[model samples]
Target: MENLPKGSPKLINAWAFYDWANSVYSLVIATAVFPIYYESVTSSNGGMVDFLGITLPNSSLLSYSLSFSFLIVAFLSPILSGIADYSGNKKSFMKFFCYLGSLSVISLFFFRDTNTLWIGILATILASVGFWGSIVFYNSYLPEIAFPEQHDRVSAKGFMFGYTGSVLLLAFNLTMIMKPEWYGIMDETLPARISFLMVGIWWMGFAQYTFHYLPSNVYNRKPRKDFIFKGVKELKEVLIGLKKLTTLKQFLIAFFLYSIGVQTIILLAGIYGKVELGIETSQLIITILLIQIVAIFGAFLFSRISERIGNIKTLKLTIAIWGFICFAAYLLDKDNKYIDIQFYALGGVIGMVLGAIQSLSRSTYSKLLPETEDHTTYFSFFDVTEKIAIVLGTFIFGFVGSITNSMRNSIFILAIFFLLGYIVLSFMKKIEPVK
Candidate 1:
């Protein structure tokens, strides 16, 4: 493992630009505007229309489709990760996924009121698969780029840049859609569609910087082999790694359990505000903008705190804060006009902790895993747990909301997850990074 060139601004910028590129998908399509647009397009005029003689809210159908997409991503991610590792083509695989995702985002412009439901659903599934699949390889590259000692700072910096990039793009897109009159755009929807197109262009354009500057790994002891059999072998090795976690198994278990609450909030925060709290779409976009803006400062703050108190202590504090946030969500009024203020405040708190949790967690787990040529294969299990946690958390929220008809009540259940995870994490031994 050679050291990356110190103060190589191009290398750092290139790595960070990948974050910049992918975050557009997260900000524009996944979070702010598209879900609302999907609901609007699918809505009926208060009629019990039969789809195969079964009546359902268009929103429910959308949620179901989203959940199904997660399921497919969960199943395919590790397999694809294994294939990438075996072929030593993680970079190519990432590019393919990025292209698929960005193309799908741009194609959202074609989804009009007259578009078929299947078209929207198919697009969502393709985009989700690409987004989630690409992350496995992307995260694996962290250790390759930065040494163990530098992982925390470098990873945090990447996240900070990502949040900043997301905010910058979201600001432009929000202005276009929210104040189309000022921009001389006749139709608000046209700007919204153009916003999606911008995400694709931004993602495609910035990715080239990374591909140009980052050196490809050249150490190869074995020739390229059959991808199918190699993927299976890698999958078996991952399962074996999970089973071999004798002392650190408790830490992995805690991460797996607690991540459910973390992922649920990330995925559903915008939808919760728009649907349950009756927040206007523009207000919801502004709230997300605030999250990204505050998160930049928050990452720096946590980096300083971790320097003083250590990563484990900072993480413990973050878990405690998450518990309180979940409890606060339950207390917020479902119909309160001031609910957006509460959400904005909550987003601030989340911003303060998000980078710390992700950066520290990655560094901590990298220390725990064995040194292997197939590091990405093993890391795929970590990725799998994350996706599965998200799937389960979303499923739980949706199930509870459907049954109880209250998002607040469903949020109360998240506190239990946080508390249990905190307790589990407290018991695990401190992780020491490899020298």
Candidate 2:
């Protein structure tokens, strides 16, 4: 491993390209196709899913499964990231997760019947874990790959690639699934199943470009035979160090608060539209595509804004808008004549802030990390924070929807989380470039 130049465009683009490779899982499996497919399948099968030998509302079951998977990853990331850093094999670890995730996605093609419902839920959980687990190591590379000053723009570039790449694939998938007759396919399920297979191949195939270029071990550390226990020691050291890093600590708190709302919205938005609001499958797909398209501009636009107004201020603005989105969501009702139009309007606002918040959050946290070779350990903490937030958010969203039998109240409840996040951000100091 050599000390690579900080601003090498080739290396940076290689790093960004991984986003292109992996984001199909996000758009297709997590956000767009699978959730809608899951809902449609479950709804047709008596609206009750058999999970762990118990029958439950399909929506609640899916939400709880997601919450459970994220919880497992959040607990494991710190230790696993510690080992990757110690062994100087973060890339290997990342690849392992990618394989796990992509393969799990491909396996979903087998999940077509009510009796196979467990396979869908189990596969979804593993796929999510694989995707998110890789992200911990992937994010750790930011501080090593780019100078702190370049963090915002570089992060935005990665997200922009992600949006564009996922949109391209998703649009193709949409055409095949939504209008099967146009493709001369009488079975709608066949195309959707094929989309799953395509996502796995796309994820693993494009990732080769990233793997070809990214350095295997930039620091080139040689771990001792006791590396496993030493990894735990490294993780403990990072935990102790974080207690004294007041600025980073505060930002993590704020991030956790906002993520509760933001992540829940992303994971559940399609399902919410389909089941609760009675939005057509075609309309939902179009709305998600609109988000991906608009998000490219949003990522670049907010990157510049952050440069001009500062990261903290930029983030504050985004969080406030997220709160407003929640409030607006509360007002949407199926009885309204312009319900579809209102939903699209919500999608527009979601797009405007979605990429901005994600890119900015990653860069801001990267900038805040202390000077150390334990990049993976630090980032694991960041990843864990958001993962736990997702757990809490999904659990509460599902719980509320279950008890009340309405998703609107769950949407309204999420608004307070964004408000709390905004208030916490007010106390965070401006970020200084890491020397």
Off by over 4 Å in 1: 1-9, 47-55, 275-278, 334-339
Alpha-carbon TM-score of each model against the true structure: 0.91, 0.95
| Model 1 C-alpha RMSD to native | 2.9
lDDT of 2 by residue, 280-304 (tens): 8888888999888889999999999
Clashes in candidate 2: how many? 0
How many pairs of residues collide in each model?
A: 0, 0
Query: Which candidate has the top score in lDDT?
Result: 2
Candidate 1 lDDT over residue span 273-327, tens digit each? 7777777777776777887777777777776776777766777888898888888
**Model 2, 4: alpha-carbon shift in Å?**
5.0
